[model samples]
Target: MKILITGANGQLGQEVSRLIPDASRPGRNEMDMADPGAVGRTLDEIQPDLIFNCAAMTDVDGCEKDRNSAYMINSVSPSVIAQYCIKTGARVVHFSTDYVFDGTRGMYTEEDAPDPVNYYGLSKILGDFAVIPLSNSLIIRTSGVFGEKMNFPLFVYTSLRDGKEINAIESSYSPVNAANLARASVEVERKGLSGILNIAGDRISRYEMALGIARFFGMDESLVRKGNKIPGGIARRPFDSSLDISRATKLLDWDFHSLESNISRLDVH
Candidate 1:
């Protein structure tokens, strides 16, 4: 199958590229998602059978500071891609975040109404809505994704490696391994699934997740401090944005990797 992956530099995008080695992986230089014309032209040139869009303005505080860029990348760009795909008969698999929910409730089902608390969440929700009407398009809502790239777990590991004290938030989330998420994405496409689905690991708090990482890397857990209050940032984060993966688990017949297992699987230091 002719497949194209955008944001190939990102953790999830890199994992997807690894899984689909033959697929066309385009960097920002080749296909800048921020430019709608460039995205459309790229789609026209590749004419891929499937497209995986992993690009987004993911930095919450960054989004808060620059709402224009946030909406442009997170919402408008995907919508542009979706429109092009609809015209060309290409299927799309887009990645979204748990931030779409306000975190007032945990284990959010796909059917749950989204009430985003921050600009980042609002931007992603707009993206979700943008592509929902398109045929053969799927939006996977995940949380706390970690992989070889700089993420929560990797940050914790790096801080410990430097012998620096790290403060982890008490906020809870369902952390999905990027590799597992990539695998699930392919599975969902193969099964010809459409619409929204939640693909996430078991829910765990930030502190416990850090502790697990410490144990996995044989690091000093004492260096990891528990942060009771929300970390200072321009944006407000949801307290509990864990997603219920029952649908994905049953549909894909795959069990997502636990935090410890995910950590052990990583080859990076």
Candidate 2:
């Protein structure tokens, strides 16, 4: 099957590329998502049966500062891709975030209404709406993504390597990894599951997650400082952004692991 993946250099995109059976990944240099004409032309050339989009403007603070740029990347680009999928009858698999919901509830379901709190969330929510009309579109809303080349663990590693104190929010929740998320997306797409699905790690606090990561790296857990989103600076993060994965598990016959388990599975070389 011919497949096209955007954001070929990102963590999830790279994982997807690794899994694809002789895949074709066109970087931004070949096909800039920001340019609608380039995206359309590339899609027309590839004529792929499946289009997996892992690209987005995910920096929450940056989104808050430039809402227009966020919308252009998160919404406009995906909308253009969805239009191509509709025209070409290609199955589109798109990745979204738990930020789409306001985190007012404990566990968000697929049926829950999205009331995004931040500009990044709002922009992704817009993309979710943009592709819903396509019957072949699969929307996977995940959270707390961490993996190779990702901002989360990479930033933490940098802090630790620099011997600087690392402050992570202990109150927020989410247990997702980009590698596992990419694998899950491939399974769902292979099975032709179309609709909104919450794909995330088992719900857990950031404090416990830190301990797990510290254990994995054999580092001192004391180096990890705990902080709260409210008292701390930046946007208000969802205190309980855990997503209910019952639908994804039952329908896809898939099981997602915890952040610790995902880390354990990684080869440390």
Candidate 3:
């Protein structure tokens, strides 16, 4: 099947591209998501049977500072893509975040009502609503994603390597590996599944996650400090935005890796 992946240079996008090497991977220069007309034009040119929209403005604090750019990329761009897919009979697989839920509740189910506390989450929630109604779409909400690109675990690794102290939140989350998420996304599309699904790693606290990485790499765990409260930032974070992946496990018959296991697999220096 013909496939197109937007934001092919991003963390998740790169992993998805690796999984589907034959898929058309387009960078911002080829198709700027900020311009809906440009995106539509690219879609028309490719005429892909399926489109994986991995493009997103994921900088949490940055989104708080620039809400317009966040909404445009997170909400409007996906809406435009969904509209075009509707007209062209192409299927869409959009990635979403666990931030859609308020931190007061952890282990969020697909049926749970979303109450985003930050602008980033609000933008993603809006994007989710826009695409959810489409008959040919799969909105996969994942959490604390890590990949070859710089992420939470990588930040910890680099900091420790430089002999600098790191402060990790005690907040809990289900950190999914980008490679695993990419694999599951393809499986969902191949199985002709539709609607929302939660694909993430086992639930664990941020501090524990960092500490585990330090321990695995034989680094000084003491350097990884446990933060009691959410660090001061432009955005508010969910303390327990961990998602329940029971549906994904049952439907895909796939087992998600634990935080340590996923970290151990990383080839970062």
After superposition, the stretches of candidate 1 with alpha carbons farther than 4 Å from their true spots are none
How many residue pairs clash in each candidate at the backbone level? 0, 0, 0
lDDT of 3 by residue, 130-240 (tens): 899998799999998888778888888888888889998889899877888888888888899889999888888999998988888899998988788887888989889
Worst 10-residue lDDT window for candidate 1 reads: 260-269
Index of the highest-lDDT prediction: 3
Error of 1 at 170 (Å): 1.5
How far out, in Å, is residue 64 in model 1? 1.3
lDDT by residue (55-89, candidate 2, tens digit) is 88877888888888888888888888899988878
Worst 10 residues of 2 by lDDT: 260-269
> lDDT for model 2, on a 0 to 1 scale?
0.79
Mind giving the per-residue lDDT tens digits that candidate 1 earns over 1-269?
A: 78999888788998999988999987787788777778888888888989899898889999999999898889988998889877888889999899999998789999999999999999999999989998789998999888777788778878888898889888889997888889988888888999999988888989999888888888899998998899788899999999898888788764674676567655464
Each model's TM-score? 0.94, 0.89, 0.95
Q: Pairs clashing in candidate 3?
A: none
Error of 2 at 13 (Å): 0.1
Angstrom error of the Cα, residue 138, model 1: value is 1.1
